[model samples]
Every structure is written in structure tokens, then in C-alpha cells.
Target: MTPGMQIRLWLRQASKTQVGVTAVALAGVVVLLVASLTTGGHHRASTSVAAGAGAATNTGQGALAPATPEGGTGTAPVAGGTSGAAAVVSAPTTGGAAAVPGAGGTTAATAAGGTTGATGQTAGPLTASDRGVTPTTVKIGFLIANVGGLDQGGFALGLRTDIGQAIDAFVDDANKHGGMAGRKVVAVKRTEDPTNQGDLKAACDYMLRDQQVFGVVDSASNIYAATQRCYTIDNKTPLAHVYALSADFMTAGGGYDMTTTPNLDRIAKFVGAAAKQMGFVKGGEHVGIFTDACEPSNTVIRKVMAPAFKADGAATVDIAQTDCDPQAQTSQVPNAVLQMKTKNVDRMFMATSFVGVQNFLTNADAQQFHPKYFASDYDGMAADLFTKNFPPTQWDRTQGISSGYSGWLRAGHGLTPAQKRCSDILVAHGLPAMKDDAANGEVISQCDAFLNIMVPAAKAAGANLTRAGWAQASQRLGHVDVAGFQSCTYAPGKYSCGDSYASVEWRKEFQGYIQISGYRPANA
Candidate 1:
């Protein structure tokens, strides 16, 4: 039997044996659990670092208040304001040994005393002595936040999982088609404590130095800019980066280190746009935003809602902060929800993770308080998972926004050309589904805006993937064009691309199946 088959056989045989018969059985379970937990933690830390990086990358602070489902309207990411001009920024600059195209590119070895090119582009083709570069066998490390306790981090984690599933499908199909020019793409993961810098550093060190990964991808926060920039500069590992957070957050406080996915803000805007589309925007329309200051994602909700609340004019936006830990912060959210009800509030904008939102929705329902609930992508991802743990009441009240690429896949929206290519790869590989792919396609469109405008021009003189090459690759993306590919590009100075997020509203079939109902682009 093959090694994998033998391991499976051993596990199967061991399942029937008690510890009395084989102590190894008990050890195996323990080992698996520990490994899983460690991986999960690393992913979480990676998410935080990404969030912070975004925050550090921007220049202003605009807060958004949550909108209520009752009558208050919020704002969407329209193409006005300073976000359109788009700034050109350099990749994080670092000191390292200079690396030429072909010198030390053969193996996954970091050249000793090597200096990275100033281009800041995450990946470039350096002719290796080997046959050629293959997308398969190219393992990329994805670090995100998914620990159970933090709501924002947890939702982002769920989104990451969805993205991973898509990539897996894409690679499976690619291998069938003879792989990425003959190499199969494989993905690995790591998690870290999103709340701490030290943890973020530790996770990075392990993935980069120890694992010697080819590159790193993240659905990360802006807060992680410092570390991420450091890696980009030091490693010359071209990143297929996803700037999921909003441009507003990046500029907050002359640029703080707290960033998240742009989708988070876009989702919040959908809350407002949906309410307005339903005629909930008028004087005396009560809306409120609730965020867990203890969590970084909530900060994003507030930022997305600020200008939106001001723009709505008729809606009254109130802000409330909560603790990340629900058990310890019992009554904090329920009380806030009750306060909104007392004010005759009609809608709410939530900047919470799935677990936190699930709890708040349950508490609000038990109290017999009903209001139109709207949240960012953080809440939407766990919409299905929430049903498994919470009651049915939430299904009828909640609506949220998500990335177009992932949201389209999850809602079974029509596939684009790019998504189709990605899907074909999955089918060829014998993988189960492409329902959750979140990486690939025009996602790089968002990143392209930045890459196209960076200060020094990231493309090296002899670079294989030129600006034209990158742009052409991105243009081919369709909902079904490529299988589950949903990555954005990042060049030198500029970071965010203007691709707004897609929105989703929950519906109950009354027969126990709660699923996505109202879906659209939250623009206007």
C-alpha cells in the first residue's frame, strides 16, 4: 500500500482498538488535535497582522455608525471621495542580501545575506536551473485569524476556509490538465494570536524562515502592515495580497496599524444600501452601529458607517462598543440592542464576527425584540454556521455584505470565466466542490490599482511577469472564468483597488433551511 493508504489503514484499525490494546491510538488523537489547534492559532495571528498592515498603510479616519433594519439607512462604497484618486505607496522597505533572477532561485532556500529587489512585487519569475515553474507543487502559506473566542477574527477565518476550498479545487483541476505548466499548487496554513504583535512575528518567522515557503497570501487586516511590509521587502516573495479592509481605515489617525478586509466596509455599506432600496431612509429613521472595541473587525464596521451615516442624513446613527468575550460581556450586547429598541430603532449595522453576532441575535430574539439586522462580511460568512448553533429567528432579520468573488461562489451566483477555469481544475483533481473558492480572478483588480501606481515601479528590468502580463492575467477573470481564484495584486505605493463588496440578506424557508436571499452590489 502507498504511504498515505497505509496511514489511513492504520488509523482505521486503530479506531477499533482501545488504549488498553494500543496506547498508540490515544497518542494519535492527541497529536492530531494539538496540530490542528496550532495551525488554527497561526492563521488567526496572520489575519491580525494583515489588518494592522492595512491600517498602517492608509492616511485618514472616518467612522461609520451601524444601521438598524427598521428604517435607518447606511452608506455604500460609492466612487466619490478621496478613495478614487488612489495613492501610490512603496512596499515595506527592508535590508537583506541582494538576490539576482537566477542565482539562488532554484530551491526554497533564503539566500544567506541576500538583498531583495526594491520592486516590492511579491513574486517574479527567476529562471531556475530546473525545468520550469509549475503552479502545482508550489505551496503558498496562508495565515489568518480563526480562533473561536474573537468574533471578527473568527468570521475572517471562515472566509479564509471558503477561499482555501476554492484554491484546492482549482489546483485539483490544474493537475488534471497537467498542472501549472507541470507543477501542482498546494496550500498550507498557519494561525496566530491576532491581538499580539509578538505572536504575529512568531508565526511569520515559522512560515518564512522555518517553513521557507515560496510566498504568503492573506485575507488580512491593515494592522499587520508593518510586519507584512517587512516580509515583502526582506523576502522578495511576491505576494498575491488581498486588501480586504477599506481605504478609510488605512488612513485613520494619519494611518494606524489596525486594518481589515475592504469587504468588511463594503458589507456595512450594503446594510445602508439595502435599507434605502427598501425605502427605509427618511427623517427620524433610527439606526445604530454596534462594534466590539475589544476586536479589530468592529473598528472596520464603525469606519465604513461613519460617512455613510452622515450621507444618509435622515438616519440617526448611534455607536456602541462591546467586549470580544460574550460570556464575560453578558448583557452588554442585549442591553445595547434593547436600548435601540427603546429608541424605536429600525436597523442595525453590526461589525462583529459570526460567533458574536450569533450570540447577540439569539439574545435579542429571546427578548422578543425584532429589528432589521445588517452586518459586514464578518457576520455573513458564518450565516450558515450560525443557524446550526442559534435559533431560527436570526435568519429573517439579518443581512450582510461579502467579497464579490467569494459571495458569488457561496450564493451560487453565475460563474465568471475565471471562476470556471478554477472550477475545471477542481473537477480534474477529484476535489469535492468549488462552492467556497475565495482566491483568484479579478481580485487582483483591487491590488492592480496600487501595483500600477507605486513610486519606484515594482517590475524589475528582466522580470518575467511584466505590468502587461499582470494586467492581462487579471482581465481574464470571470465569476466562472477561473476556478475559485480570488486574489488582488499589490504593487509599490498604492494598495486598495476600487472593487466594492457584494451584499447578502438572510431568509428563512420556514421549513428549517435558512439561506441567502437578497443579493446585489452595494453601490449608490
Candidate 2:
């Protein structure tokens, strides 16, 4: 079907099925659990999702890498299918992107030997199979969520399209500078119904089974899970997730490794910290926690808000859950606004979607049930939504909203060498304005991390990086520094990053995000 037609059909189908809608609503969450998994790992993550719903548990191998084979080798072969060989490493070669340094192997320019680090890790040693051979080109796939209504008024669409467009720019830029290593980076775009896990499974299965993509990069939460399940379990394909928020997707233990921040926890801390700050000044002692009484977000709300409320010094923290139906935004807003009037709530923290937040705020303004508004980053989308529905000035009452991420490449961070090169390529490819999204940049980070660790380990062991080679490489996927935004840990599989805690208050004067000061860890 045409992409347009597919999205409309998907949205209609989603409106009929409860699971489908939930997947779309909490697209950010489901992606976290299923982005990567061996068959066993898929089962484990699926079990986690079911457990969150208080359902019976089913077992799967939680994201464990396959085990090594019998002894006899220092390095594995790079061939396909259970050979335990090191995958031939190739660099993007169009421009000067430069190939990865050969592990303990002599290239025409560099020596083959180097000293081992104190960590007892030496450069990877190449096997006879890698001798005098050029590395094969690696294929990466991009599954974008650009379907229209399927995402409930383009929520997923804006995310995937905007991000995908940006990433495409990034890839073009990278290709101009030379692709990764010596191989040109190619992106294959596919769109699917993220809300339907079955559909996601089918789409991803085709990518891995037929298309033979080495890895995947995507922007939807629901699709993340389905793809991870397909790649890890069905075909042993690895992935690089762009905007998934569930901590599970980005961590090694869950069998999925995403490149974006696990937002709920970060947002919870931001709201809680902001609440405490407002309380000190406004004498606000109670915290009202509001969230969508939907599927995946409900679980995220519970995980992120419960702890945040506890930390806010709230004498009592009351929670309000809104309707799961997307259309209920109209009704849920008024209900929440009315309920807030009866309760002696000192402060309010909302965990919801852009439209829902806009409805709640618009209604609250009309009803004059204004309390301190502290919400997650998704609330930013509300501003645009409000502008489209109401006048720009109507948002005056809802000002002083603050949220932060590792950093915004579009906003400019003096561009890393890699980013600069990537940006240049995009501009050269007639996408000068498109480089602002940096969608693919995030994916590149994930893939870079995967390669940075895996390539070295594969060469060191001289094992071909089949599932076993990747499994061996999985041992060190923990505790990586992704430039400057945040630090990811596969060991604990938790996300700790920018604006760990931040708050924005609607001062009668100024309106905008205000970063919080005095940083401290959440557990601390």
C-alpha cells in the first residue's frame, strides 16, 4: 500500500484495538523493551511488558549474547552463519571519512603492532581470513514512523519524519566525507504500523530475513520492540535506536541498545526537583501527579513519578490518570481541571502527550485551575499544538516550562568533527536546512558505540563476529561515554544524563525554560 494509505489504515485499525493504541500512545516506551533481543531475549522483554500489566509472566532469554564455541582460536572467521568469525570491518570510502584502524593488522600506511593497555586489552588480531581482503560493505536500515493518523495526529510522524529527514542529511554528509571505514553508508527506508507489534515483527523480519541489513535505526518505541525482537531473536540483527525512551532499549541486559535518553526517569526527576524548588518559595507542600491512564505510559508514569514524588518532600502525592483514548483529550482535560479544583494540590506534575497536555492546560486556563505546571519534555509539543488550535497568547498562562536533554545538535554545540563532516555532506546533498534535525546523528552514535567496542573485540579474539562474535563483544557494551550529553551503562543498563533535574516556573514576568542549579544524582 502507499505510505499515506497505510498510515490511515493503521490509525483506523489502532483505534479499534486497545493494544495498538497503547503502543502508539507510549511509542516511546515499548521501543525501549524490544529494540534488540535474541529469541530468548525477546521472550524476556515480552515478559517484562506483560508483567507491567500484572499479567502472567512468560520467559525469554533476556538480551544475552550467544556463548563462545570450543577452544582452538585466537580470532574467529568473518564469514556468515555461526562460524564465530570476525566480520570484516569496512570504512565509508566516498570521501575522507577514514576506515577504522585495523586491529593488530598491517595496513599499507600503519604498523600492525601496538602495546596492550593496562586493562589487558590489546588491539584485535586479524585471522588468516582477513588477509589481503577488503571488508564487505555493511548495510544499515532506517524504519521511519512517518505515517499520518496512525500516530494520532502525526505525533510519531513528526518524530520519525523530522528525525529521519535529519538523519538522511547526516548520512549524505557522511558519505560526502567518506562513509564509515571504506564502505559507503546506505539507508533503506521503510514505514510500518508501530502500534501493532505483529506488523512491526513482520516488517522487521523482512528487513533481516530478506533485505539482509546488518543493523537497524528507527525512531518509534513500539517499532523498537518489534524490531529488536526480530533482529535479536529471529535473525540476530543488531540495532541502533534513535528516540526510544525506555531504559531497556538502550541497555545491554534488555537485548536492545538505543541511542536516545530514557526520558521518563529524567523527566520525573526534573518535575520533582522543580516541585521542591517551587514549594520552598510558594509554600506548596502537596504534589499532584497526573498521567494518561493508558498502557505503556502508565507503566512509565509509575516508574518515573513514584520515586520523584517521594523525593519532592510532598506531604501527600495524589495521582490523576487520564483516558487512554486519544480522542478523550477533550474530555480528560476538563475532568482533570475540575478534579484539581476540589483537591488541595500545592503543585502539579503531568506525564502525558502533547495534545493531552494542551487540552488540560487550555481547559485549566478557561476554568482558572492554575497550579504550578511542571511536566516532561514531550510537553514542548503542546506549545505548537496550542498555537495551531488557540492563539499564541493563550499559552501565556502556561509559560515557564523547562526540560533538557544531553544536548541539541540542531541548537548547535560547536559541532564535533564527525558532526561537522556529516553536516557538510547533508548540505552538499541539497539538504542544507535539513541538517538541523540530527536524527541520524543519534543513530550514528549508537552504531559508533557498537562498532567502537565490537570491532576491537572481534579483531582481538580473531573470531568472525557472527552472533558469537557479537556476543563476545557484548561483554564490554557497558559504561560508554557518548560525547558529552550522557553516560550509558549496560552493566546496570540505566541512563544518567543532562538536566537530570530541572524546573521551569511561570513567573508573572518571564516565560520559558529555566535550567535548575545544584546538581545531584537521583539515588544520592
**What tens digits encode model 2's per-residue C-alpha lDDT throughout 1-524?**
00111121123223335434544553321111112222111111011111112221222212322212100011111111111112222321112121333332233211333222214343343222221122323345666553444345334423323445555565554444334333334555565554444455555655565555555655343333333445544455545443433333233223334343334445444555555555532433665665554422344445555555665555655666554434454455676666666676656665555445556566767777766555444323212211233222333434222323212332234554434544454455565432322234333443333333323333333322243333334444555443312334433223223323233323223332223332334331
Q: Which residues of candidate 2, in runs, are more than 4 Å off?
A: 1-135, 148-186, 193-198, 221-228, 232-236, 248-255, 277-284, 378-422, 428-430, 433-463, 467-492, 495-524
Q: 73 in model 2: Cα distance from truth in Å?
A: 41
Clashes of 2: 49
lDDT of 2: 0.39
Candidate of highest lDDT: 2
lDDT of 1 by residue, 265-286 (tens): 4445655565565544545566
